[model samples]
Target chain A: MDMGPHATFIWTAYGLSATVVSALILRAMLDERRQRRALARLEAQGIRRRSDVAQERRG
Target chain B: MLSFATLANPSFFMRLTDRVLPWLAGVWILLLAAGLYMSFFVAPADYQQGETVRIMFIHVPFAWLAMFCYMIIAVSSIGSLIWRHPLADVSAKAAAPIGAAFTLLALVTGSLWGKPMWGAYWVWDARLTSVLVLFFLYLGLIALWESIEDPSRAGRAAAILAIVGVVNIPIIKFSVDWWNTLHQPASVMRAGGPTIHPTILWPLLVMAVAFSLMFLWLHLKAMRAEILRRRVETMMMTRVSSAVALKAAE
Candidate 1:
């Protein structure tokens, strides 16, 4: 059997899929870390509502 | 369970993430690296179908993850509806976009692979049509969640929809068999054995593991982000309310 150039289609598809999924995973990680840190800062400043803060304090 | 609620505490979550995120990031990078190496270089080209079979490494895994993500959202939604777990709602909501993304990837990659192999890009095949419906279901859940102003109400409503939509997952899986369609019937996930050879099977399995790990890492990250966003919104609203009260006093 003569295996020819059309085989490139499968390799290209796999390559593109890997690239896209990797990009998404990286983006989610960065966004989550950034947002978590920011929220931690806000929580630390005693900036929450009285009711919410009281719940936390009581717990 | 209330005692364990501390796990969901924003500060506790932040602390846990400091320890966990790096490991998860490392695993994602390492696994993807290994999976790609094995997929592209280590794995041999298919004998019968030649290189086009290589597309299975990505297309099959994404298809699995898309279904897996939908199951997660449905289960979490049910949990939220029954127990009113705020985190479950956050999980269900956060997973919608990611699930939709995976589903879209599956469709696009399948189409790309299909064109050369099946000689068509689009077909009203059963498996393909049901998968498209699953993608739309994800979008609908996301849109419905965003449409409501009240978070709690929105969560409950979206949860109901998620649970109701779950009946379609099995339909999506069985569609190829239930109807004679252009799409191939289940081979890997059959009762007897996978029809694909061991060489192709190993890479595909490794890729599936890598995809699952990636999904876990991202789903956790997205859930954490949703939680933080809610916390930030609450903090901002509190500050505004206090400023109004102080102005009234003055």
Candidate 2:
């Protein structure tokens, strides 16, 4: 697209926005994966939440 | 109907988000695609600013989201402090980095837009300066959360800071009117409504909605991660306590 004399500024703004937003999405996805993995590992070792343990005992 | 109590439950929140996220993602993607097409192809170049006005398509949304995200944090902080809502601090904590990212984008994009139009890359104007303060507030909240070891303590401390820092929001909004600034006064949002032509306004609105959806999607995912992290912390503490009890029994 012909962005006149200041095309550089226009493209750079869009590029930077895309970069920052993509980074945020990547970080959120990675952090969620890490937490889920840690929770699963702890559960595998029979370490469960107190609420879960209490529910199990009652059942 | 889901009650406030049910919505506040972490497990319920997690499950609900899991079901809602996929749909939200779909809508967000479609709207973003449409917004970009409209911005680049449909919106005409300004007679005065020329094509540089294209930058506003993204810049304005980023600027709006920056304030919007901070407002979310502040409201969540209030919930954390007063009602002691279980999910409130998680909401605030998850929102900090996202809010910071948006604020940084707003500043950088504004600078980029300013250089060609305003003849400088940086300005100490009221609107710009207040926004800078908002960015620092986001950073302070993030640091406060990270510095403390205990989650509850960290949440309380961060909540206080978030609440106190919220005064900056109104200041940022009214800065142009309150003080002479290179930045233009409110156009899209004002007493008479948007001054921009319809061609530019439509794409801007579409992009704003798309950006908001994107924020909501990310915030939900971050909150889920936080809930899991808390669960892990509780389980680890229980294990340690059980081991100590066994050692004492010996």
Query: Chain A of candidate 1 scores what in TM-score?
Result: 0.66
Best by lDDT: 2
Question: How does model 1 fare in lDDT?
Answer: 0.83
Model 2 regions lying over 4 Å from their true place: none
lDDT by residue (B13-54, candidate 1, tens digit) is 667776897797788678877877777777777776566676
- Cα-based TM-score, every candidate: 0.89, 0.98
Which docking class does model 1 fall in? medium
List, residue by residue over A1-59, the lDDT tens digit for candidate 1: 22256656665665677677777777787877787687778778767656576887999
**TM-score leader:** 2
Error of 1 at A28 (Å): 1.4
lDDT of 1 at B31: 80
Scoring each candidate complex against the real one, what DockQ results? 0.57, 0.88
Candidate 1: DockQ?
0.57
lDDT (C-alpha) at residue A53 in model 2? 80
- What overall lDDT goes with each candidate model? 0.83, 0.94
